[model samples]
Target: MVRTADEASVFPDVVVASIQMAPKVGSKAANLKRSIELIEEAAGHGAVIAVLPELANTGYVFSSRREAFELAEAVPDGESASAWIDVARRCKIHVVAGIAERVEDRLYNAAIVAGPKGYIGTYRKLHLWGDEHLFFESGDLGLPVFHTEIGRLGAVICYDGWFPEVYRLLAMRGADIVCMPTNWVPMPGQAGEHMAMANTLAMANAHSNGLNIICADRIGTERGQPFIGQSLIVGAQGWPIAGPASKDREEILYASINLKETRRARHLNAFNDVLRDRRDDIYDPMLGTGWPLPRH
Candidate 1:
């Protein structure tokens, strides 16, 4: 594991929190206020890092394009990002929350990372899901990892979780922790409150990539669409350290993570390295040129 002199000497137990709250449709003000409350609550509990659900400040289920358009704001200059930056600076914690991003004429499904120092970076969701395609422009920024005082932080939003490449890219970039801001709806044919596919995906992604993943999801139905509220803070071992929180209640989940151990855990054994053992040479021959047209 490659570590900077500063990072190597500063290993400490860090607490991560995931906030699961219900966001009202078209109520941007109420959603931002509620998000601030949850953030304050998490910070008070000694969480050094906190995650919030997708479109946390604007809410999901926009009645129309104009509704989404009206609610979207500019990136670090936006009110929502600026507010979160203020709270993060005041609480001395890192905040990762999803918001609607408006850049000139385009709107995007985006998440921003703010810390005690102020706004750090932004990640727009690379993959669009369902109605989101109608509202958001596909993310142009590739996977980026922000180096921080605590550890390296990487972020993903909602549908981006479905792509293994997202996690692999982040892990390869040496990210110690990944914060996911999601708005998961129930998948058809996947019934009951068993483990949600979102949780399963999070677990599998964490295990395969050998990085800790913290996920925050919303609860309650908006515009006849029900959200699967199972906020989680996964350890480096790919298991839940905190919660899959309740499916219907608004809650905050917290867990302590040791990032140094996570860096060591990526080595499966003396004989195998998860990233080093890839048969990419063979696979690349087929994939390097992009899909070679569908097999006849």
Candidate 2:
């Protein structure tokens, strides 16, 4: 039997926290203030890596293109992002939050990763969901893994989690953790009903790829659309370490990610390997091999 080792000695255990927020629409200043407060709270509790929800600076539902544009700001230098940077630097922790980014006249639904040093990197949402396409351009930056002093970190927005390839690609690139900033809404019948589908997706992806996933979701309803809040942090083994926080309350969820265990756990057994056993020679669209035939 393969046994687990001393977690602290291998690599410092990563204390991660998720902030499930409720941002008032068109309230940038108020939103920014609240986010900073929450980030500080997480940092105070020894969370080295903290994540916030989608469009955290601006409310999720937009009444007009002009509003989204008005709310959108330049990353790193943007009002919201800069404020977050200050908090991250002050608290000496890494912060990843979703924001609306504008370049020229085009706007992108994006997330920015900031740490104690300064801004690390950004990721625009690759898969735009529902009404998002009407307001923002699909992400062009692609999936980027930021190598930080803590570990290899990656960011993916709300809708991007639905695609398996997104998780797979991040894992293939040696990403140890993924920060998911989401504004999760209920599925067709999920409203105030069963467990949130978003949580299930995160867990499954983590287990399948041996990746730790931290999801921060927003609470409350906006412009008649209600967000299903159940922010959670899943370990590399696909177990919820912190929460599926209350569906209607603003809260924080915490978990510790062991990078060494992730690398070790991927071995599964002496026989099966999650990533190494892949038949990448077959299905990748870039290969120009077309659809593979039956294995007769």
Candidate 3:
């Protein structure tokens, strides 16, 4: 319920709810039901924005494209997304949920943002991880931010969070907040390591770009692979306002984001200004002709 200066705001703070739930593999109806329950709970709590983990509607780690496609659904026509849209409109909030999208005949790891106005925007997973390349098509849609009642929201699916350039581009496009719906697997003893990486990504990117970064990661073990749920909310200063918790239970992390802080941080550190300091003219060789080095 965070409101800007121009609007008469009821809620002065921006509340974001990040959901961590286990998705039933290939069961669209069950997944949709769980998503709806979480969305309703978040909305009831007066959250202006709610984010679910990547592939929330379908468990990740599919063995074949057919399996992935079987779980995929059309954009707005998809029952899961459509139901969330109704909830968003009814609750008057913004929702960002991940789904396996069936685009014509191709399948994609997609994230859809819905509000009272219906599906506002969609971002397909730009960076596939491990065996993902074998089952889904990489998204070509460029990084773009969507203007919503909450604020300028940008999204990057699970694997895409590993990249820095994406955050830079989103920041350049005037994103107040960036959402990452991730499915990070926790190695036997590497939970701390994974959380550190996620924290670094959130803090470094937000502090440098002067944008709020929220990540909703899946919890619990799926197919015997443990997922460490560390859903968090980081301010523009790269500090965790919410969490970096373990994966034993489901919890809602809330933070009141002040857009004014972004401007203040940028004024003080101004790391984004570094982008303007770049000399593209001198780096032309980096974008060299399409040729591989000679394999002598």
Task: Provide the lowest-lDDT 10-residue window in model 3.
Answer: 287-296
Q: Which residue pairs come into collision in candidate 1?
A: none
> What is the lDDT, from 0 to 100, of the residue 179 in candidate 1?
95
Candidate 2 lands at a TM-score of: 0.93
Which digits, one per residue and each the tens of the lDDT, describe model 2 over residues 37-126? 999999999999999999999998999899999999999898999999999999999999999999999999999999999999999999
The CA lDDT at 182 in model 2 is 96
Clashing pairs in 3: none
Candidate ordering by TM-score (highest first): 2, 1, 3
**Local accuracy by lDDT, each model:** 0.87, 0.89, 0.77
| Top candidate by TM-score | 2
Which lDDT tens digits does candidate 3 get at residues 150-241? 67899998778778777767766678888888888754456445565666778887877677888888877766667778788888878898
Q: Write the per-residue lDDT of candidate 1 for residues 1-296, one digit (tens) a residue.
A: 46677865777779889999999977888999999999999999999999999999888898888999999999899888899999999999999999999999899999999999999999999999999988889999978899999989999998899988888778777788999999999986768758888888889888887889999999999989999898888887788888989999999998988777787667789997666666666765322223222111
Off by over 4 Å in 1: 1-9, 285-296
Q: Could you give the candidate ranking by lDDT, starting with the highest?
A: 2, 1, 3
TM-score of 1: 0.92
RMSD, each candidate, Å?
5.6, 4.5, 6.9
Question: Which candidate model has the greater lDDT, 1 or 2?
Answer: 2
